[model samples]
Target: MTKHNSPLLGSHMSLSKSTNYLEGVVNETVNQNANTFMIFTGAPQNTKRVPVETFKIAEMNQLIDYHEIDKSKLVVHAPYLINLSNPVNETVWKFSIDFLLEEIKRCEALGIHLLVLHPGAYTKGSLEQGLQQLIKALDLVTDYESPVLIALETMSGKGTEVGGQLDDLAFVLQQVKKPERIGVCLDTCHLHDAGYQIQNWPEFKNNLKQLLPLDKVKVIHLNDSKNVCGAKKDRHENIGYGQIGFDTLVEIVWDEELTTVPKILETPYIDNLSPYKKEIKCLLSRSFNQDLK
Candidate 1:
């Protein structure tokens, strides 16, 4: 076991389901012993699109001050409708760009340092062409400030999604002139589904080191996969409840190289927030007593 703390331990909590609003959610998460946290700024479903309001920013700042959550420990998930790789007409592209820009601005205003986004799927074009489109779309967006890091999440490589592979993600980073403005949010479940052996500690670490530098890894989505490795399925199961066993999580919790990053659980919280608390506690209890050989 390695005495690791690179990623501050936390879980994703839904603000829409809570009665206490964003501030209450932060308080509850902090009370639960989370040093880091993730939240959806808008409704997850495609109901009425809610505009990002200024009051939300004020509330978020208040919560941050109350909880003392370092601005770096907080991350916001972008809306589900954004797809930079969409090969649709210019109208769809324009809508996605606007939506993503607004999300970036909201995150920036609230003092959140990172915003995790699913690099959109290419609907009808070749994968290569779609990737180029993604780069182009990112280039066109101007709402994000230099301080805000737009994190492109690794996908499950199920279809025409442009970010399943490390090379694909690197390609996007390479194309964008603002390299410092881009970062990565690695999801364990997605990596597993994309055929990475996350359960093997040495392999996992080496793979990441080869694919990306530690500095570029700004956030981690610590999820267990409901699907088998290489299945390209996107189902997220409770930690240790899916194909990703408890041993794998033990390795992750104790890994020395990742101790400083923000590892937020994206697990299913169907049984209220109790399951999330349990998951965080479980990881915290791991023995980070020695280095991995």
Candidate 2:
């Protein structure tokens, strides 16, 4: 039997102009010996996409099954250019909502369970209005009929983006019309940059207890931060190189509460996937050692 306790560790696979994005993700992730991974449905900035035909969907599912890939652990990252919180730009806001709806439909088509989405930037509005707009947009776009869960990502506190704060994300969860279809993805880099100090796991535990149920945390981005604590910058360094550092990053991923959650690396990709391969080995080695003890 496959071990139920092993973490679903992997990195986001690039999907540049590939005719086979879904199969590419499965092949690359399985090659890394990772149990799970993340991918964008299309180009993150543009709406251009590979046409999803009946054969494509069938092939994608067959490929995943052939690799013994766990569908629930597979994550579909929503495009980056969406701005559901843009209160001043009605055109952008409308597009964001529509784009989001389409993303969910794509997830459904691919049979992927979780969709990771940045909650979006406020652009030109108060934090209150920004959050309200996010809530409103979510309410508009959510579909109770779809099985896909939208996992709202924590942001680096840069600019006017929502979800830098845990409560900000929780509030959206509380207000959204379909709470059952929504969850959270905590990015370690964003958490540190947003000033959450999750490296201090005990305090982080306390914070997690205060903020939301641990089960509601559907995903974790395990990147280290390139900036200092409370810096509000979103730059990502490789696993051990930045502020989160080696020991803490290892410990964070191995924590029992997060072990079952899918942990993905959105780190700066270096040549030939060596960085992620090494990071996956490093983190899992520590975890295996801890299990032996």
Report backbone clashes per prediction. Answer: 8, 0
Question: What TM-scores do the predictions have?
Answer: 0.88, 0.91
Q: Candidate 2: where is the Cα deviation over 4 Å?
A: 1-5, 16-20, 54-56, 271-274, 287-293
Most accurate candidate by TM-score:
2
Model 1, span 51-159: residue lDDT tens: 5552356776667666666767688888878888877667877888888887787776667768888888888887887788788888877435547788899989998
Q: Candidate 2 lDDT, tens digit per residue, 1-293? A: 12346677888887543536566666667667787888887889999887655225665677667766677888889999998888889999999999888988888877888999998888878889999999898888774478888899999889888898999998988888888878999899999999987778778877787878888999999998889989999999887778878788888777887777899988886664346766787788864222211
Q: What TM-score, to 2 decimals, does candidate 1 have?
A: 0.88
Show the lowest summed lDDT stretch of 10 residues, model 1.
Answer: 284-293
**Decoy 2 TM-score against native:** 0.91
lDDT of 1: 0.76
Q: For model 2, what is the error of residue 66's alpha carbon versus the real structure, in angstroms, after optimal superposition?
A: 3.8
Q: After superposition, how far is residue 65 of candidate 1 from its true place, in Å?
A: 3.7
Candidate lDDT values, in order: 0.76, 0.81
